[model samples]
Structure formats: structure tokens, C-alpha cells
Target: MNTPADRATRVQDIVTVFLLSITAVLTAWCGFESSKWGGEMSIAFSQASSARVQAAAAAGEARDARQFDLQIYTQWVVATADEREQLAAYVEDRFPERLKVAFDAWVDGGMAEDSPLVVDAYVAPGDAEAADLTARADGKFQEALENNQRGDNYSLLTVMFALVLFLGAMSQRDITRWVSRTLLGLGVVVALVGIGLLTTFPIKI
Candidate 1:
């Protein structure tokens, strides 16, 4: 103490208690934030998994549709001239609603059996919709991954807050003045940083 006393004064003891309490509060806050982030990450992961499954199913359906169209085209190729005209008319009539715009354009431009209207990416009406689903599913997965990373950040801060608590406990000793000061300073700095992170992170709670 500056009062020529070897023992700590009342003000020093109060300061020590205040610092210890701050560390404890910050530790709890960080722990809560970490838990909230983890829960949110879990929810995000669940949504992503669901979307992925849906995308896979839609892709399979699109493949099946493509196969059906290809089969019809194959049958048309082996038919007689009269049968060929009838089959072609049937094929044109059965063309997908989603593909009508392109099919009409192809007709206007002189319809060909090998045109891109059927051979391109969207073989069926749902194929284009399925591709859109795949893109949306991928976006959900990316969002989930970002949430997982932010959860990990909160977990790291939880550890840092725990360390602050440990350092605070260590500071309450009859060590050398510099050693005590070092421990206290470390605890305060870590607590401040932990609180900052908990507030700024995407974890709402």
C-alpha cells in the first residue's frame, strides 16, 4: 500500500472483489453465449441436412424424367414413315409445359428431333425447378457452415472466459507484487475481450 503498510488497504480489497466479480460475470455470460450459438448451429445443420435430402430426391426425379424422354425419342427413331409422323406429333404434344416456350421457338425456327429443347439440361418441366431447388439447398448448406464456424468462435471465447476465472482465482495470493499485478491484469484483459466477443458475435442470446 502507498500508506507504508505491507498489507492491502480496504480500497485495494474492494478493488480485488470487484475484479473477481467481473470475471465471474463475464465467464457466465460467455458460457451462455456459447451454448446459444451451439443450439443455433444445430438447428442450422438440421435445416441444411433436410434441404440436401430434398435436393437429392429431386435430382433423381429429374434423371428419371430425362430417361423417359430419351426412351420416347428412341422409339420414334425406329418407326415407319406414317408411324414416325404420328409419333412425332405425339412427342410434340407431350412436351413439358415448362419447355413450351423453347419448344415453340424451336418450331418457329424449324423443329429438329435433335434440338436442344429436349437434349439440354431441362428434359422435363420439373427439371428446371429441381435445379433451382439444388441451388437453394446449396445456399442453405453454406449458411449452416457459416453458423457452425461462428459457434466454434463462441466456444473458443468460452474457454478464454474460463481461463480468466482461473487467473482471477490465482491473483488472490501473497505473491510478489509484480506477479499479482500480472495475474490481475491478465484476468481483466481476457474478461474484457471475452465480453466483447460475446456481444459482437451472431449468437443472439
Candidate 2:
């Protein structure tokens, strides 16, 4: 019922549709992957930033607490037993009291990502406010320290999750399998390095 030329044209149209379908599918798949990767990257960045801020806060607070303890101890050294007891009681009340207030301040400030302002708030130099800042620094330092410590863990987990997500993104067949495997391995290595850096880097008190 059909001429040879008509049959040939029909076949060509079918082939064209097939090719276009393949391309569309591939594009859609890649777009999905890209979106996922973007999300993971964003989450990782946020967590890393938060962790850094917390670490700084914790370290600053711990140092301040130590210094406060030292000052209190110094004061206790020259005082009478009754005076020392009074001072001890005062310190017990004051340090904990200030700690509560400073902690509330830190949290109310939104536990934001690390910035120069946050660091400056905790560790300013050559200022006569060291005495006043001691409590604040101690509180922030402790918060930051705890965060850094947890950051190591969080970073490691995120790296692992990224590796998995990347692998999923590369669901194409006929490519070298080694490429994906190699990327996974490299991700692990990168995660280890991040952990090492966090562990080895000494924070300023």
C-alpha cells in the first residue's frame, strides 16, 4: 500500500524521534543529578560554617573560664579563710551566672556562621576589657570548641554522603567504571584530610 520512498521516510522519522527521546532523557537525568549535588554542597557548606563558629565560641569560652578561675584563685591566695570562702561563693555564683547570660546571648544571636565579627567578639587584643571579656570569651570558646569537635564528625559524614550522591549521579552505562570508583576513593581521602586539619589546627584561646 506504500511506495518505497514513503516507507523510507517513515523509518527516518521514527529514528529521529528515538534519538530525540534519548537526548531528552539524558538531559533530564543530568538535571536531576545536578540539583541533588547542589543541595548536598549547600548543606555541607552550612554545616561546616556552623561548626567553625561553634568551635571558635567554645575555645574562647573555655580559655576565659580558665582565666577567670585563675584570677579567682589568685584573689583567694591572699585572703583570710572566711574571705576566701566568701570569694569562692561569689565566684561560684558570678561565673555560672554570667555563663548563663552569655550563653543566652550567643544563642539569641542565632548561632550564626563564623565571621570576623564573631571572632573579634571573642578574642580581641590589647583591650582593657579583658576582665569584662573573660566571661564572654570563655563561654564562646567552649561553644566553638564543642562545635569544632563535632564538625570533624559532621564533615566526615557529609563527605561520605557526597560520595554516594556523586556515584548516583553517574548512572550512565558504557563509561569506565573506574572513574566513579576513583572519585569515591578520592572523596574518602579528602574527608580524612579535613578531619586531620581540624584535629591538628590549634585554636587561639
Best candidate according to TM-score: 1
Put down candidate 1 lDDT per residue, 1-205, tens digits, no spaces.
Answer: 3564444545545666887787677666666766776777678777767777777787788787667655654554455345778867777677566454555665566666465345343356455666777777777777777777776787788688778767867777878767876887888888887778777877465
RMSD (Å) of each candidate, 1 decimal: 3.4, 18.2
> What C-alpha lDDT, on a 0 to 100 scale, does residue 35 get in candidate 2?
47
TM-score versus the correct structure, for each prediction: 0.78, 0.33
Q: Please provide, for model 2 over 1-205, each residue's C-alpha lDDT reduced to its tens digit, 9 standing for 90 to 100.
A: 9999768546644543443344344334434444454445455556556555555666576676647644654454445355677765565455344343543454567756232123224432223344444445455456555545454444444444444344334422235546644544454454455445444533322
Cα-based lDDT at residue 38, candidate 2 = 45
For lDDT, the strongest prediction is 1
State the TM-score for model 2. Answer: 0.33
**Candidate 2 residue spans exceeding 4 A from truth:** 1-12, 73-205
Task: Quote the lDDT for 114 in model 2.
Answer: 37
